[model samples]
Target: MSSKGSHSGWTRRRLLGRSVLAGAAVAAPSIVKGAQPTFAQTLSISALGKAKIDWQQFKGEDITVAVIPAGYFNNLIDVAGAFEDLSGVKVRFEKIPPGQIRQKILLDLSSKTGTYATHAADPMYYPLYVTNKWVEPLDAYLNDPKISDPGWFDYDDILEGWRSACSIEGKPYGIPFDGEATVQVYRKDVYEKAGIKPAQTLEQFVANAAKVHDPANRLWGAALRGFRGAGQNMYIYPSIFRAFGGEWFDPNKKLVVTTEPAVKALEWYVNLLRNYAPPGVENWNWPDIADAFGQGTVAVYIDAHSSAGVINDPQKSKVIGKIGYARWPRGPAGKRVTSIWNWSFPVNAALSERKKKATWLFIQWA
Candidate 1:
């Protein structure tokens, strides 16, 4: 395939990196520095898109980046050799766990250590990062013709929702590395045998789940994240809360989890797990749910779009062509809500100007 057609797959893989290592949430740092790269020929198109930018602009600079040890960073490491050769910039990566990356970045910034010139920023914790002014605003680097080639980078091509999610107060703190949303993936064969179409409303979703549930025959109605903790609950609850017209906080920012809508949302969520989910689902996270769906042990699974890629891979999935994808069903409020997750690369404000600029070059390259 041509580079343009294949680029989306690469970007999708990068987006899925953080969630790849399930149940391995420990804090340790591993560094990957690119060796001198050699290329066979001059390529016309960049790995990013159809447009070509002058990547050699920042020759002979060194940059250090801290990232969660997800698939995205692994892919980045694979390509770093080429970037080093093209730009003459030695790129070093510090791999940290997804759960501890934020704390590590904060400490490095506050201590003026500049240990990491750039770090990955998760949208969930971006508000706090912005509040503390820990990341450098990327507007200047993005707009500079010398730094970013609009024709090549095509910043506007990024989905508006994804772009906006990475921005705070209308200013972009970082460039979007990956974007994803919650989606429902189901077994087409199972639905066909049961004579039911994909659910279009919340009520139908629940009913269909119950209808196809056959635990006695080793089939499950649904596979969902049921693990307790902010990381696990955050994925499933936000969409339910939004679907039910429940807000996390009032206009004054007071707690509102006990509101009528909130209660209904939580009740529905818990009941779905209690009644339809497989045994021991209470401890299941994304990886567990993904394994169930891929193994064809579940009829329906709802989580990030990242899992769909794995489920559709013929070699990795038992139900390859039998999968169907759909949006979340509409709630009683007539709204079908879903939450977004994005990873962005933001330069550390604590870095020297030269280091920041060099780091920006690497960010643009990635």
Candidate 2:
């Protein structure tokens, strides 16, 4: 299908295209109808630019990167060999568990050991990293003509929200590799049977969940992350809090999580899980919730957009064509708020200039 037609309408291709790794499962057609470019036809222009990137610019440079075992790691592994061959840059990946990768990177940065030239970063920690001068500012390399292919790199193609998310104090410290936002994905067939549309408001969301819930048949109304920790709670609760106009801290940085809006949002979040989620949901994290959704046991699932890619994959999901995606529901305060989750690549501030430039080239390739 033509790129214009593929994106202008809500075809399965378009739906999956929004997915993080959807390209791996779906085969691209060799030819496209009409006067439009096929995937291969567009590659010459889209891959980099008319002016190809000089991959060998930093040949024979070796750099280490620290990454969590997540989607980005899988993507990197898929093309790391090619990058090494073309650029003569020996890439070393230090795989760390998701929960510990942040701390590990921070320690490496603070110690100034330069153990890792570049590390995967979560935008949530941008403030902390910027405050400590742990990450290198990427503007110089990004704009340098000798180092980067501005036309091919197509920095503007990145979504503005993602760009802003990786920036601190108007300076970009990281390059967003993958981005996700909280969204509602539901069983469209179930909603159709119930004669209901996707929820637009928080109250309607709960009502829809209750209406479609069928425990006798092993189906639950919703699946969500409830594991207690910064990892789980921090990911799921902020949307509820923001929707209800709850702020975490005052202008002076005084704690405000105990305020009325905050308490109400928390109460609502707890009640939904307690009443509508599957049993043992209190221990569920992103993986558990995703598994439940993929198994066709949940009517509604709210989490990162990346999970939708998995749940929509025919090989991994029971509800491959039965899903519908929507933005997070609005709250009583007439606000719909969602949190952005991104994994970015940032150079270590401690790396030597040559290493930094080489790392930047790899980042661009990635």
Candidate 3:
């Protein structure tokens, strides 16, 4: 979509095309179609220009980025107008819900339909992408003089754990945007009134929840992600599973979901939410749980650290300063296995060679 962010013939891109830094400031970007802002006024054209590559080479191309609707991903969409102005590439953001995005991304890539040039990716999917050759090796783009300036991109600035986790043989298949771990968030005021401290162990965790569970007051004990998706409940469950001493695979490399530890962990987790959480929690996702906590209807929550943004925002949260944060509690095995994950953006191998250039530009700029 063409940005309505333009006035007369002036744009951040037009200014950039003439002088890298001069006349940098203009009107705040108008909201473009979807969530994109109007111009790349905040982007440093001078630094990118130093690479001596043609930023406008793909000026008329269009690419779509399939993103799970979240703050970090929204931050990228917010500035897409600037990218569109700068590259003359029309960018569309499909802000799919978290539950449905994984399936769509997988199908788009595996089917090689090129429906999306890039997508919000999960770090765990890199190995499969590499093995199946479904994604372009990003090192080629990162090192290409025609499309990249490694020094300008600051390749080493990113954490090795995150960067390497998205690479195969030093060739990155994805660009990691956000790294997060699960944390326990509860209402401190409610806990104080109930005469209980935050949980340090699974036993204490449930006990604390039970102690504060006051559904009669419209306050349930806890709200957790219960929606059915690998990236939904499955994303939050591994921490619980590891805490319960459950391993995903046996030493011989067979799947291990039926093990005693696995069953015990799943049963405990399911029962906890079903019994103590608000009604219909089986259909809830992270945002839903966060909303419950923000609206003062839930006393505690367990989900991604990023969800804390929603729970702490004064604009949307009533609990505000009333919330307390802590590490995930210990399980019966005495292990505190917090969930660790990252979201990445990868170029779809399905995209045409020429379209991949525009996709790389978007990823690098983002």
lDDT for 339 in candidate 2 is: 81
Mark the regions of model 1 whose C-alpha exceeds 4 Å error after superposition: 1-57, 68-73, 94-97, 103-112, 228-231
- TM-scores, in order shown? 0.81, 0.82, 0.85
TM-score of structure candidate 1: 0.81
Highest TM-score against the true fold, candidate? 3
* lDDT (10s digit) by residue, model 2, range 47-119: 3322246767778788987776555455454345545655677887777766677788778888999998887
Q: lDDT per residue, candidate 1, 1-366, as tens digits?
A: 113334643453343233333312332348768633323112312443333455666677788888866554665665566667667778888887655776787788777788888888767666776788877888888788767766556566677887887788888887787677889889999999999988888778889899999999889998678886544767777888888888888899998898888889888888988999999998887767877888989999778887775676555679888999999988877898977877788888888887788888777667
Stretches off by above 4 angstroms in model 3 are 1-43, 47-52, 168-171
Model 3 worst lDDT run, 10 consecutive residues: 20-29
What TM-score does candidate 3 reach?
0.85
> Cα lDDT for residue 35, model 2?
20
